[model samples]
Target: MAKHSKKSTNLWSTPAAQVLRATDDTRVEEIDFSLTPGFDGTKADAQELLAERGQVLSALQEKLYANGRSGDLRSILLVLQGMDTAGKGGMVRHVIGLVDPQGVDLASFGVPTKEEREHHYLWRIRNELPGGGKIGVFDRSHYEDVLVVAVHDLVPRQVWEPRFDEINAFEKELVDEGTLVVKVALFVSPEEQRTRLQERLDRPDKYWKYNPGDVTERGFLPQYRLAYQRILDRTNTDYAPWHVIPADRKWYSRLAVTELLIDALERLDLDWPAADFDVEVEKQRLANS
Candidate 1:
């Protein structure tokens, strides 16, 4: 197990907080999100990173399964949020693919149904929370209340502003109940996103991923950028912190995520369930037979 040094300083206290506070679009762009250590998927060999991440994920899954059988009931919820072509689906498919399918549930939130829209924003999300001994992956999560809704102005400032607190409370409740929430925002540069979107348009198999609507959304990049900053500012908590991953390099992103998972699971001293035997009862039953 890798021993990570305790985080002596809060992320908010660092220079990253200055970037988060910058509301000016030009100034925000100056913030370097690539400084974090991990796989530089773009420059590094993709196959090597994939193999390393696979091994790490396999270990985590084994520990989780064993812990489940021992009745420890540890739950993990991973929230993946990013722009189109940010590799959210790919991360779920590649990094977590090796995990026992039965032990994990992947929830992808799309357009809300009429029933879902009728209730509070988090109503549908709460229904899908992972039970004890299970892992839940959210392709895009309730953070959208702040991200997309904020970008589109689908809700008023008064309505969405308060959601930050509501979300914090919701996550706190989950963590208090033995749920380990790991929120990840995959950050892909506009240039990289453009390249991926172009590829989607050019490739026959990926054509389905391209839409005129994406161009419309791309126009609101500034708004989404602001919304993303707000998400990092408000939702990052001690119990359920967010990891901002550089998604320009998909392999590096996967490695960083796998390392994060391993780090979390290592904190829980999991062990296989012990065997129990009733020697006297077995002997009596045998004699009767």
Candidate 2:
């Protein structure tokens, strides 16, 4: 748990990375996920911010893709964890949608199939990891073993408890291999979650998104709370930090994700890949043609 420097610049108001970052002293329970730290304007303001963040992300993603083309061998992964209706799908659609889909490898883990159950929890996850110079999104991801399984007692405590360290090691390996890991916990209040779930049930267009089992899972929030608490406590390392986003405001959640991701990409200090062949020769050949 190395200390991060105290940056004073407020990107949106409390600084993008500072207040959002989950560290040793970060009290997950104390955070007001519903609070809008800045941007007191109407919905239009939020939409404008979203567009700006999207453009910034698109530019950085192109740089990463070019870096990969030049054989730079670097990449990034975004792991999103949250309760149902926390807007994981929305984040993907709004943020990752702005980038080239080919460069983004999205792995949305669901209930394991019979064959998948035969393998280790991380086996499927390992198979979907992005190659160098690509972006990866783990929607739900291996964190299920700890959060979901731990909440339901699907596995014994001993079986799932050790996975915190295992996850840390796995993420560290990614970092050492030129993959930056960014983890996010989309925090939604119980009341807001209920409203979103109701909206799913109410709207015919959203009928497909509604899940009967989500109601069952709602009853286990207490257990899930403990599980998520441990997740932040154990795995919020310097190599891979966890961001707790307030998902109550869907606009803020989406914009903040795009902004934070852009911040991470900018920190990479990526550059345009050097031309592989003689640039002057190619220019002359094209000019002659």
Candidate 3:
């Protein structure tokens, strides 16, 4: 394969990751979920742009995979934490689906199984970490230990409270070893969530996608908001920062995530692995054969 040149710039003057990243002072209530921060284009424009960016993203991913195969220790872990109907699935299909499946490792964490429950909260998560040179995506993630567990009082305060620091340490260790953890929380307004849920009930084809528990979860939005605020304030670190993307507009969410993935891969500055054989000798041998 031919070597690809890294792109000097992206579509926006600033990368979407910087535009959407959460800070120590970030308040979930103050963010406008429907607003597209770094993009002024319409949905159609976004769709077109996403198609164009896909090619660049694909090339970079190939480089990452090739480097990994050649003994590079670096990898990426994209943690997506979002409420139901926040477009997590769509982002996966549109953005991640563009890359070579062999180069990506994806996991969707829901209710733990009997086997998963027997171990520590991060046990299942640890097993699913992506190997060197691959993109690992967690659809929902270990934060559920805090967000969902804390919201419903599934565990005592003493149990779930200490996980924030534990998670920070785990991520820092991963970073120190070579994993670039890109954590994202998708913010969707209640009104939009209701509309999306209702559409699932209204359409037969979408019925399979709907979950009854989503409604029950919707009722606890206030509590979830407070919990997420604390998560942003505490778990948002410089080494493994959180990018709170406004996910109300499906197209924008897809585009924003695509850019975020691009940024993560780009920072690696990977190149195609050098051929190990002598080119002239191999060429003469092949020609003679």
Candidate 4:
């Protein structure tokens, strides 16, 4: 392993992520996704920033993996929630995709299977949590139980109400067990989403992504907004914070997420695990052969 200087991160802080991070002081309703933090550069500039940040992210992930290779148990799990066409797939492809897939555990939750419906909502989530030294990304996570279930009235309010506390408790458990949980809500403007959806209809290659149900989902934005507001308010805890990303602009969201993950990984100050074997002796033995 080689040592890499930590210089790339300094350029990535622009479009302040603090405003997007939800805290005890945050008002989720006040968040405006139309203007998110990020550089107002040309497309090329955005690509350059992503490439640089990707390098830093990849290095940090490698270090996290190295630490775990020797038995350290700290890891990260990123929970992403957003409306359809909010760039969740893009985040996976461009951001987390920069790291080694073997070290990354990705799960996308859709309509629950008949079996998943029989157990606690968090059951499947627990199975997918990142192990020691890995990075996990959830395209749509357990929050669906609250957001979709509440919005669609899949479960009664009484049943869903306790879940807010249950979710908080579950996240706390993850943090106590040494997994850093990061929940993100990608805020895509309805107008931008319309444009994306329209593009899918117009482009034959993208038709596969256009689901007629999306038209119905679009009608529930107001209800979903209320659901998300409560979700952010009730579930934001000190141990596992939620970051609301402004996702109208694809480039900015990708940049913001990359910066967020880099910040989290960098704070760990992960060091390369020391070689477990005698390096010089092994080298000499190989030379003799």
lDDT of 3 at 255: 83
As a TM-score, model 1 comes out at 0.83
Per-residue CA lDDT of model 3 for 1-289, tens digit only, reads 3223333243465669888888777889988888888887788878888887888788889999999999998999999999999988887888999999999999999999999999999999999999999999999999999999999999999999999999999999999999999998998999999999999999999999999999999899999999999898879999999999999899888888888888888888777899878999999999999
Q: What is the lDDT of residue 216 in candidate 3?
A: 95
- Each model's TM-score, in the order given? 0.83, 0.93, 0.95, 0.92
lDDT of model 2 at residue 134? 90
RMSD of each: 5.8, 4.1, 2.6, 2.5
Q: Rate the local accuracy (lDDT) of all candidates.
A: 0.73, 0.84, 0.89, 0.84
Clashes of each: 0, 1, 0, 2
**Residue clash pairs of candidate 2:** 74-133
Top lDDT: which candidate number?
A: 3
Q: Where does candidate 3 clash, by residue pair?
A: none
For candidate 3, which ten residues in a row score worst on lDDT? Answer: 1-10
Instruction: Say which candidate scores most in TM-score.
Output: 3
Q: Write the per-residue lDDT of candidate 2 for residues 1-289, one digit (tens) a residue.
A: 1112222123356655666888787776777878765445446676876776676688888889889877887899999999999999998998889899978989999999998899999999999998877999999999999988888889999999899999999999989999989899998888999999999989999999999999998998888877888999999999999998888988888877876788788888988888789999999999999
- In model 2, the worst 10-residue window by lDDT is 1-10
For 107-220, candidate 4 gives per-residue lDDT tens digits of 999999999999999999998899899999999999999999999999899999999999999999999998888788898888889999999999999999999999899999
